[model samples]
Target chain A: MILPYYIIIPLLAAFLISLIAGKKDNWAVILSVIATTALLVLSLFSFISMKDETVTYSMSAWSLPYGIVLVQDALTSFILVMVSIISFTSLIFSIQYIRHLSMDWKYYSLFMLLVTGMNGVIITGDFFNLYVFMEIALFSAFALVAYGSRAEEFEAAFKYAVMGSVSSFLILAGIAVTYSATSTLTMAKVAEVLPTNDQKVIFWIGALFMAGFGLKAAAMPFHAWLPDAHSSAPAPISSMLSGVLIKALGIYVLIRIFYNVFNAPEIFTKIFLVLGTISIIIGVFLAIGQWDMKRLLAYHSISQIGYILLGMGIATPLGILGAVFHLFNHAIFKSLLFYNAGSVEMALGTRDLRKMGNLMKILPTTSQTSLIASLSISGIPPFNGFFSKLIIIIAALQAGLPWYAVFAIIGSLLTLASFMKVQRYGFKGETTVESVENKVGWRMNTAMIILAVLCIATSLMVVPGIQEVTLDPVVKVIADKTEYIQLVLGGMNGN
Target chain B: MQQNDGMTLIVKTVTRISVWMILLYGIYIIFHGHLSPGGGFAGGVIIALALLNVLLAFGRKFTSEWLNISFLHDLESASATLFLVIGILGISLGGAFLANFMNKGELFALLSAGTILTLNIFIGIKVGMSLFLVVWVLAGSKIVKGE
Candidate 1:
């Protein structure tokens, strides 16, 4: 059924790019462009067919409970689309972003491998398979983090690796325990067999997932690795990591397992709420103090992720729909911001806000894109972020969690304040004579322009009738976990 | 680079065989998952560790030529493909997605596990090769550095 193309094409590209990418760097660019573009098309196709169908592909003509499996539904297809779009834009951005870097082929290879992992994570249905993909993404991220190999970059990568390893180990252990309990690793089987009365082991598994995936998502307290890692990575990579990778590997899986497989208790709702609230309050406060451009965005990522979890934590249909909408919105604008940061770095060679002043006239496109992204992320009217945040806040109030609504609003305002600081210091001030002399690359400009356009375009997903078709099925997946499992497994048996 | 004079402990060689042992044991666990305990992930880890052991023993030069971080990479991706095919077949067969053990050939036999065994093998190869490559790249990073 060609379920594995997402994983295969990237792997093939990485292999070919590495083999043929000596000195003639354009080959690497062409390869990644083709691969990402194809992925984007495939994802769009999946989205079109996914609403009313569940696709199950078995291995070697085997059935589930005995063979490997891949399931595609509205949720998976939607995420796949998001993953591919960001990857495509990022690859475009890399053409100019990595122009000065050494070992251009290796960088491109790692980047493609990273995309493969993200794609695999979003599309895979098996629990163990998810772990394997997580490792692929994490390992690639580790290498990318240290690509610069500056003392600080190496230091940050090492920190990220250590913490990531711990998180991975926790997930490994959780999967092991879950297997021991359920005697099956497939999500369908677990949902079918999961007991209503939670045991100690179930609690342990929950804790393990919370710690492991939370670390990946950069949730509060577990988020120590985020700022350093995001700030140090090249801008496009930073965008990818913050924009899509975290949502895919961390929050998406967390929600899937919690809602479907584990059939988690009401306690999870409260736990997610507390976690989300804390992250919202703390992440923005921390971001407000950041001097580095990417670092500021990294912290806001934490705060933004808070709203997603908070919305999902409510566990209402509106809450889940809001969460999904916010997830999509965040992916677009956050990546746009990262692209803007990359453009700034490409021109100035520094992400330090203090070193960047009043260059709006010098880099008008970048300045305008940065403004749109900042305003969108801060929940300004007419952009996608505003509607998503509004849905989450309204959902919170409807769920009788009025305090969470307040926190969400405050977080949004703080996000606005922080980005305002960035706009004032980084883009609004006078361009120095030295800064004005610096030339920006065409590829970087083109990439940012495309992403900026997307930031504006994705707002259509929130349009009343439009969202019913594109976003509703995805929210239905979350709202009807029982139906999801039944549909996937039922389809697997062709019933 | 520091060189030990004599009796130096080589983590690579020892880790190789251990990785192999883990791989074989992982297979045992995965295939036996339905009747007893353990499933694809634990079993897959064992298998991956085994392959990783061989890579450690050979060093990046030999492992690079043999496992070839690039080649192992393809194996990892292909296994995921195999996994997807299995799930879709279930759909085509009129079962739900990922509906395993539907045929119910024999309960405890190796072949009886049906899709469970296939999932195990696929995960074993994917995890084994991917982890091995991760360790290999990390240890032999000096070789990977280029301009």
Candidate 2:
């Protein structure tokens, strides 16, 4: 009962708010907060209740493969926590950020809609249902990106929409082919009936999904639209898009479908590994060259996502654990990083690194949090990023992939260089422009500070004892897809 | 109105009928998916085409008024909500995500076809509505030239 409400409440709120948004902005903002807050609480409860349990709910009381299904395992619970936290923080950020906009109502309404779609994607059990929710998320995101209607924003939104639509079509085509081949739509049913040998049809379908999702994930070859989209979106939106949207919509679906549904082959793992490596190396190099703050961070998002994908693709115990842990860490630090960037832009009226300097004295909270996020991302000790990267490196070395470890280290060093440049040019220098104005909003500082705290607090999950209880089961779900099918069928039988 | 309005109406009618044909064919594929080929997504594209045709033929204002862009927005949100709600039913019943066919009453009948049909329709509405809305907005006068 609570499971469905996690998705439905947000959707309903988005609708109701949009209907009345024209009349009152305050109402929309309040409703949006209430919706996301409810989700945060519900997801937290689901995490606690399902610690040792796997629960499945059939839609409309219909039976399996015949009726739509929603499943909540340890993995879903973990992702649910990530989604709600990021969304809640971003909504709070939006409260102040949207005050100046002429279309404040549209902004809040679309934000709620995007959250609704993301939550739907995370919780739904069916494959085609996944595609539908993907559309919801993408459509709302497109509209949100264009809400400002500036020339650059419009151009960016158009490019993002076209690429997104093509991906959607590819995904739809893949689903069509898969349905033809397996004669089933339920993810578990496909897994059950899937042939052992590699079918050409399945290979094509897999490629299509990878391309479709890869574009969304902003992986190396398919990542052209990301910098433009992220940089052009409003500050709070950029935070959410970079923080959790790509991971939930892109990497999460890739892992869920390929690993669990298609039972990905060795070849697929190799493909993912190569793409992850390229994204890390290329994204970091490109980020180092950028003068714009958001564009640089956008490039880093691609790099960090690569690390997550690399850990998961390695498919070793330590690797999978590292991947999941890194995902959580990335969500925290990346969102914090974006908030800091937003604050700098808000204060200085520019995101160009060359135009700004000496922000340490002017905006202490923003500067400090940005430093923490930079250190965390650059894998400094005591930060959560260090442990996950270390685990991934060790896993790579153990798997006899020494080159991957080398790339990971190199990426870390390059990231440090880029962030150090940021510190020098933006925060630590005396070349501050006299014309540069600074007005630090309480809302901006508060949002960045909270995420900065979350960045450090989440590091405790890396502790061995804590890992055993919280992260281990979720990793286990990925390691054994067969258990997923068996559990669902068994639960159905018993129910 | 005038002859120009009559001509425009004729064009829209032709486009609308063609879109319906495509949509109906897509639905045929979705229903026959279990034993033969095609499924929710293929059916969805067809449905989207029908809506797209309406948007294209009727022009932005008429389509927005007829489809009610705001109402379509609500429908789109509701479809996704419904999709998730349906999936949660499996979890509440103590099963996995999308774990359908619990009772196994029968396999071939229209009502007996199970969750596949329901999933198909939900996806159809979601895709159709989203795609149409996007096309409508892009083609609409709301899009400023420089912007």
- Each model's lDDT comes to 0.81, 0.82
Best by DockQ: 2
Where in model 1 is the C-alpha error above 4 Å? A196-199, A434-438, B1-147
Q: Estimate each model's TM-score.
A: 0.81, 0.82
Candidate 2 lDDT over residue span A183-205, tens digit each: 88877777777665358776888
lDDT (tens digit, per residue) of candidate 2 on B1-147:
232432387787697569768778877866665545667677777777877776566655565556667777778767765766666565656354454644544666554455667777777777777777767666654534541
- Tell me, per candidate, how large a share of the native contacts it keeps: 0.00, 0.09
lDDT of 1 by residue, A9-58 (tens): 78778766765665578898898899888888888887886575678777
Error of 1 at A427 (Å): 0.5
iRMS of candidate 1, Å? 7.9
DockQ category of candidate 1: incorrect
